[model samples]
Target: MKKLILPFLCIFLLVSCKNETKQGDSNSNELGTAVKDTVIVEVPKVPIEKTIKEIKEALTAKGFKTFEYVDETTKDTILMQQYFMAFLKRSAIKMQNEEESERLQKLHMEHLSKMHELGYADISGPFGDDGDISGVTIYNVPTLKMADSLAKSDPMVQAGRLEIEIHPWWAAKGIGLR
Candidate 1:
């Protein structure tokens, strides 16, 4: 997150030069005419193409792996983006009481919901069987480090009830399950 903010902050500081003149302040000219304080702010006009380019550029800037492929049937360009699959596994710690366990479970669900709401996770679900791997979450983040951090931020993982194993995965940029 800091990586995302610093660069934009620097650019904003550089481009955002504002005149120090106040509203009521009037600096007289050589002729003693009243000079009104004026400030210039240029709002950029972005077209659709430029927006698309910026999205691609941002993805690349974030160290995301992406590629475009021409579909044979429709001859349309398809963007394939890399995602991370987090395997939520069982941890050694299981000492929580019933009430505490219930609370942690609720918090865990809330965390997952927030991740989905924030577009950080594409999909997440638990496994049916009682196995070492408990659940899986597909993270729609740019880098493995980001996915790892988000996964570690899960309440269950932080409580030592679950462990995380992540791997790089890929899919169509805008494709959804049927």
Candidate 2:
């Protein structure tokens, strides 16, 4: 029994190492020189200064602004034109009954249309019923207070059917339809 176990273990070890040895041998010629079949290309290194200059040039060419990294703690990195916007996060639980919900929806549409006409709203849409938040409305306002004021004017918010959380947001200046 001991002899049979030893032979089986030896056979397993030989089988496992057979493939690796064959692969290693194929990578070299009979003379032990790395064959032309296996090509090894080394990447050329560019100086740090030259690489940085090239990156900056590429960004400039593509109309992108570049800036140096500052210390941590704040996310203020690149200096792009900052625009104030508002995000209206609809509450997950509906406070209104069916009738109230329908009425407020109408009011909401009217209010959004008014915002669109005034060039204050960039985008607005519902987030589907499955999500924690009901919908999102992005407003192109000048200040957080202004965004809150505009949000408060919604009939749903006034009736306590929808909750509004006002936040100050900054984004790239020229985006979305004019």
Best-fitting candidate, scored by TM-score: 1
Deviating ranges (above 4 Å) for candidate 2: 1-96
Q: Please count the clashing residue pairs in each candidate, in the order shown.
A: 0, 0
State every prediction's TM-score relative to the real structure: 0.66, 0.48
Question: 72-93, model 1: which lDDT tens digit per residue?
Answer: 9999777788999999999999
lDDT of each: 0.88, 0.65
Give the winner by lDDT. Answer: 1
Model 1 scores what on Cα lDDT?
0.88
Model 2 — which ten-residue stretch has the worst lDDT?
76-85
Instruction: Determine which window of 10 residues in candidate 1 has minimal summed lDDT.
Output: 17-26
Which residue pairs of candidate 1 clash? none
Model 2 scores a TM of 0.48
Which ranges of candidate 1 are over 4 A from the true structure? 1-55
Shift of residue 131 alpha carbon in model 2, Å: 2.9
